[model samples]
Target: MSIEREDLMICPARVTLDAAQMAFFDGLPTKAPSVQAELGCELEQGHEGSHAALGQQVDTTMWWIQWTLSASEINPYTWCPATHLPDTERRDDKDCALFNGHPGSHSSAKRSWQASEAA
Candidate 1:
């Protein structure tokens, strides 16, 4: 049976990297062509800083990467392989959203809802 777009749910997958893995990722070529080809999606990476309060332990900086998943890669019955990091452990799933419509596309449902509210 075919599944509709709105019926699908997306979630994020995390990969915690060690020192060596982090170095390898940092040394990757600009634009990360090889990594992108392997993952089948565009990627954007950045460093996320952490803050601590008094008497609390300071959090270490981590490399944060986000990517978009292809339609075929999404599986409602199982967890989708969102990101494939080199030699890292998996973590809990994070909430994700999927937008099917293209930019500037008209939304008939939105219009209908507006009309109903006006009545």
Candidate 2:
């Protein structure tokens, strides 16, 4: 997915929401997506030495039941901060959604643009 200019501000370090804000997540409607299990994790170097940031990586599996929870009958997909996104690009193949709608684009295009080595 293309990273919007606003996405540059997205950081996991700044935890703005308070405990009360997350209290409702526990009561998320039955249809709400659930993190039933954490299959595994792949850690990468963080900006600081010896510290790693946790972002979804290959071999890390999360099972979710798609659901639309509402507040005052309004779906809050826009306000929900925990939107799911893959941390790394895998491939353009069907098995991978790195290029789900961009058929002709090379899977390594982003990597080349970013000038980073593959994981």
Candidate 3:
């Protein structure tokens, strides 16, 4: 099965996942559930500073949400494999995509969790 590429989004708040959010993530795959159940999740913080490359000075701001997911949970969301951007089929949130997919693919609880997340 192929996950879509647009549903993933790096949460901007850099906040920890709430109970509902945690529940949502728990239904993705065995790997994701296990990881969420264990280490939990954390939104990523961006790097701050300047660097020189090729004799040119440049500045950059990076952003992402990082969580200790299992090997199987890696790239579980629908995202551009290369760019990591939301793709055409990607859901607005990971939970939506997770529950929307077949139970054979993952878990069924995520869909209900996503509904709560959206409200």
- Taking all chains together, each candidate's TM-score versus the true structure is 0.20, 0.20, 0.22
Off by over 4 Å in 3: 1-13, 33-77, 81-119
| Per-model C-alpha RMSD | 19.9, 15.1, 16.8
Clashes of 1: 0
Show where candidate 1 strays beyond 4 Å.
Answer: 1-8, 31-119
Q: Which of candidates 2 and 3 is the stronger one according to lDDT?
A: 3
Candidate 2: C-alpha lDDT: 0.24
How would you encode candidate 2's per-residue C-alpha lDDT over 3-86 as one tens digit per residue? 754234222232122343334344554332322222111111122211111111222221111211221111121111121345
Clash pairs, candidate 1, are none
| lDDT ranking from best candidate downward | 3, 1, 2
Clashes of 3: 9
Model 2 TM-score, 2 decimals: 0.20
Candidate 3 local lDDT, residue 12 = 28
lDDT of 1 by residue, 5-113 (tens): 4323212223333454345555644332222212211111221221100110112121223223221221112212233344334322121111221122111212222
| Higher-TM-score candidate of 2 and 3 | 3
Query: How many residue pairs of model 2 clash at the backbone?
Result: 0
Clashing residue pairs in all predictions, respectively, total 0, 0, 9
